[model samples]
Target: MGETTTGLVPTTVRGEVEGQDLIMWEQLTDAARSGLTNAGFAAPIIDEAFMPNLESARPSF
Candidate 1:
């Protein structure tokens, strides 16, 4: 509880100030997320991503 002109004003950091998960979730929605998190870029983060093995080549006749 904090002081105000007429009463005490209660405030919170969106979900919960102390919880890291909530903070991370909030961060995902924030302005910084425009550059930091890309849902389309997650393909490489997971194992077994599809990519052509450049080393292997067909013998050119």
Candidate 2:
């Protein structure tokens, strides 16, 4: 997801996953980071609020 001063928005990529989604999220996040870096933006501080949710949502093996 991407957020601007106006509001939050979803990315064009969307899907359903059966297991831990961090790998997926990380990939997406990395892409975003790379984009920002390429555009000369500083490294972003991801919102910490999402961490707990991501951890809990991980698929237990």
Candidate 3:
């Protein structure tokens, strides 16, 4: 099964890190993303903190 949750990553993933706000996602600019893709990379690694709602997507135990 599959599901989708939509929101701005920066706002969605914001949290406290060392007592300060932390944004987990570092979305690349279009040029940079294209450059990476052209250079044979799929995409930049995303932090687990930025993972979409897996609890809802996963098959229930």
Sorted on lDDT, highest at the top, how do the candidates line up? 2, 1, 3
Worst 10-residue lDDT window for candidate 2 reads: 40-49
Per-residue lDDT of 1-61 in model 2, one digit per residue for the tens?
A: 4457544443555574334445544566777767754663342334654687678779999
lDDT of each: 0.50, 0.56, 0.48
TM-score of each predicted structure versus truth: 0.19, 0.24, 0.23
CA lDDT for candidate 1: 0.50
Off by over 4 Å in 1: 1-23, 38-43, 46-61
Error of 3 at 28 (Å): 0.4
How close to the true structure is residue 15 of candidate 3, measured as C-alpha lDDT? 65
The residue-by-residue lDDT of candidate 1 on 27-60, one tens digit each, is 4656667655445753353234333333234455
**Residue 50 in candidate 3 has what lDDT?**
36
lDDT string for model 3 (1-61, tens) is 2343442233234465234566433566778766655573333334442355555567877
Off by over 4 Å in 2: 1-46
